[model samples]
Target: MKSKFFIKGVISILLIFLSMYLIDVFVTIPNNVSIKVNEIKYSFKGKIIEKFAVRNTEPTHLKVLIKYDSIITISPNPDLVDVAAVGDSLYKPANENYIFLSSNGNIKKFFYTKLSYETRSNKNFPREWRNKWLDSSMWDSSKEIN
Candidate 1:
């Protein structure tokens, strides 16, 4: 009778540990992505798991299910741009920022209109705005722009 009770206790303990391990595995969070523009840095945190649902195709583009506060923008390696609003997928850029989507369902290149001298002359221009403009200029020069 004592032996039976000991065996049952051991089994119960094992089961408890196994349950905890499984929960940890399933609930693990993904690494966050941080982007800094000028002096301001923004961070987006959540899980981005890639599971093979279909046997043939490549992971159906990794599912980036994120739970973030405010607006979150994700730029995946190579060129996958996703914008999330209130923890939900809002927009996925068909092309990069420089390549705008036209009403005709075609991609169009956007030329950078020169910034006026007055605008650049603003001594109190916010650092964030300046950084955004610089990033835009860099993107325009890159091959991925179009």
Candidate 2:
């Protein structure tokens, strides 16, 4: 009798944990990222003076140092790190969550909302979209607005 109860308890606990994991992966994280995308809007426009990776961090943080009106740093997506080159123009509008990169007269726009939605729907979206999002070959200056 005692063994039966113990087995049931363990099964119940396992089911609870599985449900929690499902909710976290499917709902919680995605909603949080979407909220952050809508809430946090940083405005900066400048030339990328430097790009470096902080190797000391757990997942090495890639950073872009910009200068124009004042100095500021941006930790963009890993894909952006490669697309953006030193001397390229970087613009983040105050009203939106778009990161625009203009390189040699060609421009690429990265929308945080789309990234968040992609992350919510597919776990491998980032890796799959890597190099595709900001590839220099796909850059178009006229199509992208400042």
Candidate 3:
């Protein structure tokens, strides 16, 4: 009887640890929201951006500028893309300022804005700029704002 009780206690401890680990893995940190805008349907590739988390407890702020031209069309709409608007925003642009939130709710992912502008230019921009814009810390992989 004594041995049985000890075994049961050990098993219970193991179960508790397992449960905690699972919770940590499944629980989302509520970092940031991501949205993707695709002009072509069913295309896996499209413009994306991640926005920082916006909650009563924590707020993320962003300011962006996009150069406009006769050939440009900002898709999705920056005004509509805000944590205040719908917790997250995503859109596709024919030609416009692309904005979105970062996944970690951090400002690092803001590089997407630079990327959009670089794409507009015929001249090749520095590789470092692209790297800076695409860096995971700078931007979220899951978020996409066209």
Candidate 4:
């Protein structure tokens, strides 16, 4: 009887983790956003999953969220590291160095992240870091905004 209860408990925990996994796999701020770079324009739709957020999506509206580590393996040229509009703020890439992004929400979620090439398992996430609440994309700089 005790073993039965133990198995049930383990299964419950696994299920919870699995649910979180599914949310990460199927959700992100719908592609209603993008970035424009002179001659290029990038866009992601506005997507929201009631209780979850992708690192590229809005975490504020999520209950179980997964963020990933984005490390800029190739430093964008300072000249190419242009400006972006994040909500009301204009974001600029580090241009010289790179930063890291982790699929976590504890404390790393609060730290500011730079525009780095998400690698390894962090692929397919938005290219830049911006709250998806603004209905915008971090990597939407493909067209001439100027």
Candidate 5:
């Protein structure tokens, strides 16, 4: 009876460890990547000096080098990258989730929605995608981060 109980306890411990490892691999890592990318904030106005693609990443990102030597990585969506020129002026307001690009008096707004979608669809991403709950107005109440 004692040996049987000991074996049962060992099996339970192994099962618990396996479950934790699976959760960390499938749930934690993917959500962390999405959260980290969304946390990047921008508040500046400058002209784009150069543009290039960042390879080796799970999802290819476009690196936009702007005036004052500032670089920002954005999603490589054609609507955002194809329309932007080297000399275009880029404006991203403080505390906002989008940027405005102007070229030859034509202005276009590029939101981070594509970034969210790409990250969620990456091969390393999990089947269960997490929502951005913090963006809700309920989280922005005065009782919160005022």
Candidate 6:
């Protein structure tokens, strides 16, 4: 009886580890696009994880801090600082000062930003793809950001 219980405990531990690995595989939201904020472009395809945390809300301004790993290459990485409301899985803007590019696609260039300006002098960018999420107006009732 004692041997059987010990063996079962070991099997349960292995199963727990295996399930954790599978969750990592499935829970990751794919971020495979190059986004251009102002003129400089930054791409985080298979790079940083896209977990944004919203904080410090005022009547006119809001702050968004995107959680990601240490960015070693992507210089001047844009933080989600001081913007209007940004919903998940949609370009759902809270006010007129913001826009959301679809989490899909390979390229998103921000031609306008009301918050902070990019001080980088470089004009080079990754190849621009057709903005597929430009007309995404329908919000999914089942999915939400908050």
By TM-score, the best candidate is 5
lDDT of each: 0.36, 0.57, 0.34, 0.29, 0.58, 0.33
- lDDT tens readout by residue for model 1, 12-112: 99999999899866664212111122112322334344333244843423344545434322333222222212222222332122322122343433322
TM-score of each model, paired residue for residue: 0.24, 0.46, 0.28, 0.28, 0.51, 0.27
Tell me which of candidates 5 and 6 scores higher on lDDT. 5
Model 2 residue runs over 4 Å out of place are 1-39, 56-69, 112-146
lDDT at 49, model 1? 42
Q: Rank the candidates by lDDT, best first.
A: 5, 2, 1, 3, 6, 4
Candidate 1: give its CA RMSD in angstroms: 19.3
Candidate 5 residue lDDT tens string, 22-138: 998777766355543443344667776666666753433445666667677655344566677777887766545566888899888765333344454455533433233233223
Which 10 consecutive positions of candidate 4 have the poorest summed lDDT?
Answer: 38-47
Of the two candidates 3 and 6, the one with more favorable lDDT, higher being better, is: 3
Q: Residue 123 lDDT in model 6?
A: 26
Candidate 2: minimum summed lDDT over ten consecutive residues — where? Answer: 137-146
Compared with the true structure, what per-residue lDDT tens digits does model 6 show for residues 63-136?
22233444222212132222222332212232222333343443343322321111111122122322222222
Candidate 4 stretches greater than 4 Å from native: 29-114, 119-122, 125-146
Candidate 5 residue pairs that clash: none
Q: Any idea how many clashes model 3 has?
A: 15
- Taking every candidate in turn, the Cα RMSD to the unseen true structure, in Å, is 19.3, 9.2, 14.3, 18.3, 9.4, 18.1
lDDT of 2 by residue, 1-146 (tens): 99999999999999999999998877675535444443335577778777776675433223344553566666665566767777888777764546788898899886523333333234433333333333322333333211
How would you encode candidate 4's per-residue C-alpha lDDT over 1-146 as one tens digit per residue?
A: 99999999999999999998888667742231221121022211111123322447533222111222321122222222122111111122232122122222211112122232222014333344322212122444442221
Query: lDDT, candidate 4, residue 32?
Result: 19
